[model samples]
Target: MNYLKKILVYALPYKRYAILNIIFNILYALFGALSFVVLMPMLNILFGENHDVITEKPVLNGLNNIGGYLKDSLTYSIQTFAENDQLKALTFIIILVIVVFLLKNIFNYMALYFGTFLRNGILKDLRDTLYTKTVNLPISFFSEKRKGDIMSRIASDVNEVQNSFLSVLEIIVREPLSVIFSIAIMLTISVKLTLFVFVFIPTAGYIISVIAKRLRQQSADVQKEQGIFLSILEETLNGLKIIKGFNAQSLFNSKFTDSTKRFFNFSNKMMNRQNIATPLSEFLGIVTIAFLLWFGGRMVLIDKSLLASSFIAFMGLAYNILTPIKALSKANNNVKRGNAAAERVLEIIETTNPLEDIPNAISKTNFKTSIDINSISFKYEDDLVLKNFSLKVLKGKSVALVGQSGSGKSTIANLVTRFYDVNDGSITLDGDNIKSLTKHSLRNLMGLVTQDSILFNDSIKNNILLGKENATDKEIIDALKIANAWEFVKDLPREIETNIGDSGNKLSGGQKQRLSIARAVLKNPPIMILDEATSALDTESERLVQEALENMMKNRTSIIIAHRLSTIQNADLIVVMQKGEIAEQGTHAELILKNGVYKKLVDMQSFE
Candidate 1:
């Protein structure tokens, strides 16, 4: 319930709907109880216990007397009927019971009808907020988490909260009120009997509550375990190639099975506990009803304080309380289960985004002189990847980073584009600290071409349009031509409209890389960062793509991370890195003359 209270902000928008539902529910409760009460007078007349009044005048009190007058007039009419034909009065009582029961159900239906708006309104707003939060959250938040787990939280967990927990609000409010109204009428007829009924309820309630105490925790565990297995499933599908290549299908199979087995065990315990609640509470309610029949029957027959018809009406009221009691007990379990889901969802909504814009951050729309990396140091964990690494790239000059694997070439591109921030020192653009600029504005000045294409399962035109939403067909074709992808795209059945399957799997390795470069080219930013852009291609494809890359680099400040030392020989400046520090720096010819690490690497390749 405390968790529910936290989520109440979502309900504020639909307060009017809630108010209307409550009004109708109150009327439904009142009429539902009154229907049983009306049965008592009808029973009395039929049994000949109370002869109907022959009233000629009525005692009145303002408008309030209207009810008494109607009762008196009905009593006189019944007397007239009984004198003429006794069977007719009996027929009228049965008709009256039927009418009251009809009205009771009518109002109940109306209460539920209005409640639909509030229920669905909460669901729509909650899903919307969850989606919005997912988009605005930082990239780093996803680094340590599984994509499948997040998807499960958004889809299944939210649905559980709605179907199971939110339904309880209606049962808690409307059903309990009906029970209260019924109990009040029962007490009015016989306070002593009602008081006796109360004693049995608390004992039954205590036993049910004790069993339900740990149910919320168990539900939470079950949901979390489900997320674990869902994550494992997602990982297996995404990395199927790696698993098969390494002959590790059995390894992933065992991991997935283990996760599902734990989920199965947890789910079994949660459902078993929930299933027991309904039958156990109902059994206890039946026992209480039996005790009431014995005790109340003795009072009516021997004690002489209770009438036969009134005792019958009281039994109806007692039976009515049992249904609500059982319903509320089941709803209580639902609320607890919902509480578990709500807590998980709320954790996400309440979590603070570590990366946020400064209040006064400026927008950097253009690069003036150069990008400067001043003594920047960073690490993913304890082991540092870059230490006091400094570099400079003047406007329109090409700078290439050439090194062995894990030499922090890609990290430089990441920091310059603000995909990540440096742990120490600063990276600045045109003499202004990159952190001082808005992230959106800082990233807009640069375009990136990674080794992986990162294409979506979308049309070719739509994928290229991602670079610039309002780009024209001509512009897209021009970018494609520059990337050397236009040739294949023009040959496709739908041409630009052709659908690229998941991660562009429908295309060849070279084709996907060309499409990636086309996207960056379409952006046409002032600076470009190519992180081993041609590393994954064959020799023939690399030669063609490298030519396309050179054309795109014209008149732009480019930072290239190169795997082939020969490809960067013509670069204006080549940075040689070894173990997170500068090992050599100069033109490729100068580095080869130095006969250091760069010379050894070049000689190993045996540059002709």
Candidate 2:
């Protein structure tokens, strides 16, 4: 319930709609009860029972006897207006009932109408907030979480919260007020009968609550299993090629089937518990009515204390009370189910990001002098990946880091991009600590071209525009030409306007790499970081991408991390890394002459 209250904060901007819905619901409940009570005189006239011949209106002596006064006043009005005409009296009563019923329905529709805005508005705002949070969270947050599970919280769980929030509104406002108005009218008709009605209420509520209490955990299990199968589906779709190649369709299918079995069982148990609500409430209501008939019938027939018409109308009002009570019991169960979803949705929205920009952080727009990494230490787990390692990249110089796998070459790229901050020590740009600068401005100083050639499903112009949002067609063509990609791009169907498929899969690996370089070339940052950008291409493709990288690297502070030793042979300095620390650093020719760790790496690549 607290989590639901937290979720309601999204409804603040649409508070006017919520307020209107509540006002209309109050009117709906008031008239809904009055519609049943107004029929007492009509029943009396139809059956020729409880008719009073009064010519004068009764005075309300005090607030306590207003019920008696109202009842008497209704009798006096009928007698005077009828003037001994039976059909005319009946006609007036029917018209009165229609008026009350009409108002009730109109209010009910108005309540639903305003509520539509509140419900959908909160839903849209909540999902939008969840997506923004997902994107703004640090890179390490996604590494430890499943993409499919996050998608479930954003899509499925937020929808559940929207539905449950509506239930909360009914449970707190509309349903209870309907019951209260009905019960208040019941008391005016007969206090003893209404008191008897109270005895059965707490018992019925307790039984319904017992069933609802067990529904929440079961609902949570169903939602969790839903996320699991969705993860399996996402994985299967992403790796469909490899799965089909290995003939492992049955394995993934088994995983999906097993998850659905658990989901099926969980859903059955939860719905079974939830389904008991209506029938159980109906049964209890009938039982209460049966007792009232016996007790109320005795007062009319044997004791002569209550009228026949009053008893019948009292019965109608009691049944009206049961209607809202039944809805209330069902609504209670809904709140419990929605509470689970609210917890999941709010969990992501409320997550504390440790990598958020510091208070009063400066925004650095330009890079000069050098980037100094002073004895930084970091670890993804218990084992350190970079231990007290330090290096300095001066302006307009290219430094290549050559290392084997697991030697932390890529970690340097991640740290330099500020995807994850160093656990100890600091990285500075031109003597200003990177942490003291806002992330947006800090990242604006560099361009990155990674191993995967990350691109979106958009036109080539749009993809390049990601680097410079306001860049022109001339700028895009110049960048493509500089990266040596314009030669192939010009022969395409739409050239710069061509639509690349998902993740740029429409282009070959070399073409994708060259496009990535073109994107970075458009940005024209002071510093460039290329993380094995040409590692996966064929020989001819590698030569073309290498030439593009060489062109882009000139006059920029570039850090090139490479697995192939041939790529870094012409770099100003090649630093050989054995573990987390540097093993050797020198010019390629100088390191070859020394016959040290650099020579060993070059010899291995040559032997292969």
Candidate 3:
């Protein structure tokens, strides 16, 4: 019920639809009972009972005996009509039956019509919140989670929540009202029979409850297995090239099949348990009806207290109770299933982000003097990636960081961008700590070009425009020219309008890197961080990309994490790092003369 309440809170925005649905459902329930109530007069007519004419109109009585008065009034009208024209009386009764049925169906349709808005409105809001939370979460949060599991929570689990949880809103209102109204009519028809019905209902409810004991746990297991298989599918797609390269298709296939097999077993158990409620409730309903027939027949035939027409109407009202009783059982099962899905979705939605901006964080818009990385220490999981490391890049002065793999060169760039905060010490820009500034404002002052050029599967123009949201055509062309991308772009089939495939796969390594540089150039930030931007390119391509980097780095306070020594030779200051500590820092000429780690690194690359 707690899970259900949490899920329903999303429906508050669309409460008008829910209220309308409830209103219509109430009307539907009233008409549903009245539909059965009118059947007594028609049955009395067919059986040739009540042959005496009603000379006077029936009187209006108090609310206590309204049911009895209504019955008498209807009988009087039928009898009065029969005296003048028997065909007309029969026709009137048939039309009344049809009108009652018609009104019942109309209210039912209106209830469903309004319910559509509530169901779909909840679905849309839930998905939108899930997607928004997923995007807003820090990058580190994904490191411990499977992409497939997250995808399942957003897609499959949300659908389950809709079907099992949100879908019950209408039934919860309509079905119960139907049962209540039907029971009320049944009580008026015969109190003794209705009392007998009350005895078996609790017994049936208990039996259904016993059958549903393990449904919630089983449903949770099914949802978990779904996430597992989806994870395997996602991983398979992402690493298909590696799998195919190693001829491991059968391995992934077996793993996926195994997961699906578990899913099948769990799903079967849950569905079988869920499927039992309908037949069980229905079977119980029939038993109660059969018992009522025997007992009611005794009263009408022998006892002579209950009328034949009233007994028949009582049977109809009793039957009406069964539909809703069955529906309530089914709804109970659905709620159990939906609870499991709700837990999974809410887990993601309610996660606490450690890297969220502080309440009073300053929003710094521009860069001024140097960026000082103080005695900073950081770790990802157990191992320390950077320890007591520091560097300073003055305004408009390009600084380069050269190091071996895992030596924390890229960690510096990550820290500067605040993608991850340091465990100890602080990084300041123009004397103010970077953590004190809003992440958006901090990142707004800089542009980054990574080792793998990240471009969306979009047109070249759209891809470049991401750097500056409202950049003009001429600005895009100039940025592309500055990055040396315009040469190849202009020669393409549609030039800048050409569609790049997924992750810009249609373009070569050099072309993609140039486009990335063009995007950064378009932004034209006060500072630029180029992390091995040309490492993946070939000789000629590297030269072209290197030229573009030089153009982008010109007069910008640049932090270059370089693999190729030749590229950073003209840097104002070069810092050489070993492990997590800096081993050397000086100009390229000074570093070469020192004959330390810097000189040795240069010598090794030269030999290669």
In model 1, where is the ten-residue run with the lowest total lDDT?
Answer: 63-72
* Top model number, lDDT: 2
Per-candidate TM vs. native?
A: 0.92, 0.97, 0.95
Q: Is candidate 1 or candidate 3 better by lDDT?
A: 3
Could you give me the TM-score of model 2 versus the true structure? 0.97
| lDDT digits (tens) for residues 311-369 of candidate 3 | 99998898898888777778878888888889999999889977788899999888889
lDDT measured at residue 419 in model 1 versus the true structure, 0 to 100:
75
Task: Return the clash pairs for model 2, or none.
Answer: none
Off by over 4 Å in 3: 52-64, 77-84
Please, what is the whole-model Cα lDDT of each candidate in the order they appear?
0.84, 0.90, 0.89
Candidate 1 on 1-608: residue-level lDDT in tens? 88877877887898887777888888888888878777876787767766545646455567535544545665666666666455777787778779888888887777777777777787788888888888777767788778877777788778777765345665767778988998877766788899999999889888888888889999998889888888988888889899999999999889989988888888888888888888998889889989998999999888988888888988888888887777777788888888888888887888787556778999888888999999999987789999999999999999999889999998898889887778999988988999889988988999999988799999999999988999999999999999999999999999999998988999998899898889989999999999999889998888878988988999999999998876787888999998788888999889888989889888887876
- In the range 1-608, model 2's lDDT, one tens digit per residue, is 88899988899999999999999999999998898778988888877875557767799899778678878888788878888588988898899999999999999999999988998999999999999999999999988887888888888888988888778889989999998998888888889888988888888888888888888899889888888888899899888989999999999999999999999999999999999989998999899899889999999999998878888988988888889888888888888888998988888899999889999999998998999999998898889998888999999989999888999899999999899999999999999999899989988999999999999999999999988999999999999999999999999999999999988989999999999999999999999999999899998999899999999998999999998777887888788886788898988899999998888888888933
TM-score of 1: 0.92
Error of 2 at 565 (Å): 1.9
